[model samples]
Target: MEAKAFDTRLFKRILKYTKPYKFRYYGVILFAVSLSVFAALRPYLLKQTVDEYIKPKDEYGLLFYVTIMGVVLILETFSSFFFVYWANLLGQDIIKDIRIKLFKHMLSFRTKYFDNTPVGQLVTRSVSDIEQIARIFSQGLFMIISDMLKMVVVLIFMFYMNWRLTWIVILAMPILVYITRIFQRKMQIAFEEVRNQVANMNTFVQERVTGMKIVQLFNREAIEYEKFKEINQKHNKAWIKTIFYNSIFFPIADIISSLTLGAVVLYGGFHILDGDKFTTFGDLFSYTMFIGMLFNPLRQIADKFNEMQMGMIAANRVFDILDSDKDVQLDGAKTANHFQGNIRFENVRFGYIENEEVLKGINLDVKKGETIAIVGATGAGKSTIINLLNRFYEINSGAIYVDNQNINDFKLESLRTQIAIVLQDVFLFADTIHNNITLNNAEITREEVIEAAKKIGVHKFIKSLPGGYDYDVKERGVMLSSGQRQLIAFLRAYVSNPSILILDEATSSIDTYSEELIQKATKKITKGRTSIIIAHRLATIVNSDKIIVMDKGQIVEEGTHQDLVTKEKGYYKNLYDSQFAVDLN
Candidate 1:
């Protein structure tokens, strides 16, 4: 995408997030203005002390003025503290809200969005990118405004003191401004590169760490480390570019500021030598101090401007996600409460990619309380059927009905609530096993959860683990074996008391003992619910009411296991023979 200029519309949209905390935001602005005013008064007070009291050698009067200066300093300190504290608090609060909103928005997206996008990129957005936005509030926008206000107030006081010197100070500003503009443009590009490289590095590390076993198993750690080094080098180079621009810009600003100060002293010295009454010694001293104050804020503003640019870029990325139309459709008005388990797919055709169908005009009818087993080679659209039933992806052209009503007419949440699925690979949160099972559903009480686990026959296994049901699964259930995780998934699905249960090769990778327990649990769970089993192991599903044989996204044969096995040239018989023929011999 082409880089966009600072967008006012995007800024206004970001500002809308502060609406709930407008009072705090406004208070920050108030403190910023107060700080600027206090800062501006310091030099003016110093000028008065020098010209009015010090010139006459009035010790007591000088002490009184000095005391007032001390008082101003204390007040200024308080103002500075309040400004920094509230500004940061406001930034933190705003970003916190934005992160939550961003995460919730992501949850509404279709599964296809996640399939195409990297998880690390999303992580960067929610964490680092949002943090950059906080800098906009804390160190970028408000600080820039405060600095500018201080400079403005200083300029006004300077002109009031001596317009001739003030005009000289003003003359050198264009040079600093010109240099800063160049720095701004260059730093913007550099910062953009830095952000991009950070995201790239994050994606690389996340994927590698998650798949470290594969990397080590294949002995490719050295190769992967070299790749990481290259990405890290690029990230370093991008930051160095920003540093280079800053090095050039700040020095130029300092030089210009110094030359301006020298010019003021030269002019005042000549006036004093000529016995000019208007250019007092105190005036020169105060102007020098004001000049220093002026240049400092100008230099800081340039840096803060760069920070603001980075924030804008981050906001743009965040808005891109929020503005996307790829979210799952949720416009269905009918609720799926008390839906019968009857399901039918009428000429269902779907594809993850255009012009490449995964499920080609499929038609299937499943009655309530029937256990149907679907068997097929990989890529035969067996799993696709379950995905479509759950509406994870929208079918390109087809109609799916539950209980004779179109599935699309049912509310997405209500439709999904009635179904439970256990995939070949299970996912568990870094939470207690009880939370994973009940998913923190208050409706499912602790006793009810234990009862469900007991019914599924995995209660003993869960109890054997340290902390039993309260065991912390740790990230992705790394603390547990595959079979143990799968058993937890079974308990989780069972406790929901879903109207439809789907086990898509859920028993594929478990041990024989776990498989036996799963088989018993499966029989109990599917007793009165509509269940769909997609299995490669035909033995596990032989007693199913119907066995469907699929090839190339089409159902080739379906019948009772006994009836299908009787066919001499049947697909099911061939599949059964391939595995059990040796046993028969």
Candidate 2:
């Protein structure tokens, strides 16, 4: 669709949020219309008071007009306050609604979507772009309406008071408007570039901050700074364009306004001097006031037009996210309320990117309560299997089943609730250990959390910490050691007690002592549940009931640890020999 300064389609969509705030919406409209009338009436009243009372030196008449003018001023003040209040209130509420919808929409997207998208770009859409959209109501759309209405009323008064003086001001308008139109479009284009650079800057900063450790570890501080400097330069240049337009436009607007006001006064004064008693001093005063009122709004309308343009640009970008559904994780209406954890993959084929399959056509099955171990070198699609089992990404072609029922036939939440995973890189929110373990699940009581931690054998270790279970793990659990974070993650997954558990190198990040503890905990947890263990360290999965060796997205071997190792040239045997110096016996 062709875009414009006043995007009708975008405007209608933004207005949809006002549905719930109809009271405030109507309040703004009423005040905008009423305030215009009140503002216009003041100059006419001043003309009347000056000509009818102040001119005659009539004491009672002057007192009466002064009292009425005071009341009008009081009323105008109240109306102005209400108008601004309702407009801002409406804007704030609408943005809150839009932000919530945006967040919820993002929640529906699959992990593949997040993998391909930058974290900072999403943050820009959620916060920065939405903020620009809010200006549509608060400082752009409603303000423009109020100013335009005032302009119309002032023009009516100008024509009534003196048409000839009105013509003087009117003649100067076309030039200002023509320039404003050009300025508005320029600002729109500049603002779009500004938004793009802002998003790029956000993406770079977010990635750098999140990986600050790596930057410092690898002595990349200077290099990253140089790269960021380049991005920052682009960001500044983009903003300067918008600022340059504003710097040029507003001054030109002010000059035109001054010239127009001066022309009205000069014309009015000359006519009055020419014995044109019809153009009285009162008429001249009102014409000057009328020019100020009319020209001021014209300049303001031009400024607000830019604000609305920026807002429309932001809305268009944000709507791109809102209207997206293709990447949203599909869920069925039927719930997997009684899944048996009997997982099966039949010739699954999938890829993170088009034409680049990460998992080739493969088939596998795990019976209920069966423990299987998958081992492979890095990039052998070890983690991809876990991702597929949990349905984090949609397969290009495949069928996955639990208890002989297709995974697609079950609700996403219902299916996921029955399974849990502990990753190599565990993420812990900045919260107390108890909250992180329970995940604020109200149904899981404190006693259950304590019991689960004890089962994982981290209960005493946690109790030894500064605050025991109440200890606050700072952002990403940085306050805790890597082993401690891994322990917390293990505890978190155990507390949920899903029917299926997948541990992806769960013990790889831990110290020797923690690994021993986790091994013991692992055995206890996997005793009677379906478990899939992905490991780089071959020693960790030596006792698995079945071992699967994968290479390059395809499973190459599958058998018990003893059975796989007995083969001299098996993939599992080769991986085991490389990981261990001792004989396979």
Candidate 3:
């Protein structure tokens, strides 16, 4: 989307984050004003020391004026220090709150939002982009205000000293202002491109690093490196464009400032020589200093304003996420405490993409404590049923009920708290094994975690590792084996004491010993809970209370193991005979 010229609404929204620390914000402004006043007085004091004390040849009076000038310099230094300190403090505090809020808002987005969004893009927004926002407070807005205040105070003193000389300097300001406006416009577009390229580079690096094993296995390093070089070139070019604009604009400003300085000196010298008492030597010296003071801040203000524009561009990107309507709106208000395990999907239809339905009018029913097995080909909608059951995605049409009330009628947290899924591709955070198991849930104590691990039959294996449960997984559990990660996933689900358990191909890809342990753990955990198993291995589900055979998003057969096997051309029978018969032979 095209960015607004000056988004007043967005500006107001950013201001809201500062309200919590308004006292500190006020302190920054107060110091900025004090600094500006001191800055203006320095040149004026110089003028007085020259004209009234030095030129009159009074040593005591000159010493007195010099001491006062020293005092003013000290005060100005103090003011400048406090201004910088408080402005930075305010920026850090405000950005801290904003970053936290942005992270929490991202957490609230639905599964589908994450499905299409890149993780590195989100990381850029959370880390790099939010940092730019902090500069808006520290180096951008507050600095711009302080610079403008300095300019105003300097202009007042110059006019008071000699309005005619002041006008001479003022004549060159229009050119500087015109150049700055053009530079700012170009810089805004360049900065936007830079931010986008940074995100693209981050995405590429993150993906390549994450899948480095696969890249190396396929010998695609040279190809991927070439791709990275292309992206890096674009990133470099975007930054160069920003530098190019800055180069053109700052020199133009310098030329204008120098011309103004020359004009002030020439005009003041002529008047002084005229002997009409039109301008004093002290006035000429002070006016020269005042002109530098005026234009120097204006130059810095241009730089600060460019920083502010980049911040606004980042704010636009961040606010887009905050304002998105794609979040899964939680409409259910009913709490699901002490939930019964019964679940039913009635005429449910869903599609991750529009017009390409994954689950088509699926109907399912499970009793309070039944174990149901769903078996199908890879794309036959078996796992989609579990996704819908957890309310990860909204149904395109129809209703799902838990304990006779619509699933949508339950509060999202309460509903999710009662359901847990252990996937085939298990994920573990880079934390202690204990933390990974309990997920830092306070209610699941250390003792209870150990007990859950013991109950799941992985306690001995865990204790065999270094530091036992205290061992760090180290980034997606790379330190652990696939079987070990799966075992951890099982323990995580078991500790929750969920009313409904989902094992989505949870045991398919694992070593034999781990499979044995998981099979034992599965029998214990699913004893009284409503469990749904989506498995590719036919042997695992033979003893389930009910077995469902699905093909092309529709269930074609439903019965016990023996009942389906007796049918000559049944989908389930064919699947079983093809695998189990070979095993027996």
Candidate 3 lDDT tens digits, 127-164: 89988988888898899999999999998888888888
Q: Tens digits of per-residue lDDT for model 1 on 1-585?
A: 335546788888888988999898888889888898889888888888898999998899999999999998999999899899888898999999989988888888888899999999999998999999999999988999899999998999998888888999999988888888777788888889998999999999999999999999999999999999999999999999999898888888889999999999999889989998888888898988999989999999889988889998898898888788756555589988876699999999999999999998899999999999999899999999999999898999989999999988988889989999999999999999999999999999989988988887888888999999899999999999999889989888988889999999999999998898899899999998899999998889999999989999999998999999999999989989997876578
Better of 1 and 3 by lDDT: 1
lDDT digits (tens) for residues 506-579 of candidate 2:
98878999998889889988988999999888888888888888889999999999999999988888777776
Overall lDDT per candidate, in order of appearance:
0.90, 0.88, 0.88
What is residue 210's positional error in candidate 1, in angstroms? 0.7
Give residue 141's error in model 3 in angstroms: 0.9
Question: Highest lDDT, which number?
Answer: 1
TM-score for all predictions?
0.97, 0.97, 0.98
TM-score of 1: 0.97
Candidate 3's clash total is 0
What C-alpha lDDT, on a 0 to 100 scale, does residue 251 get in candidate 3? 85
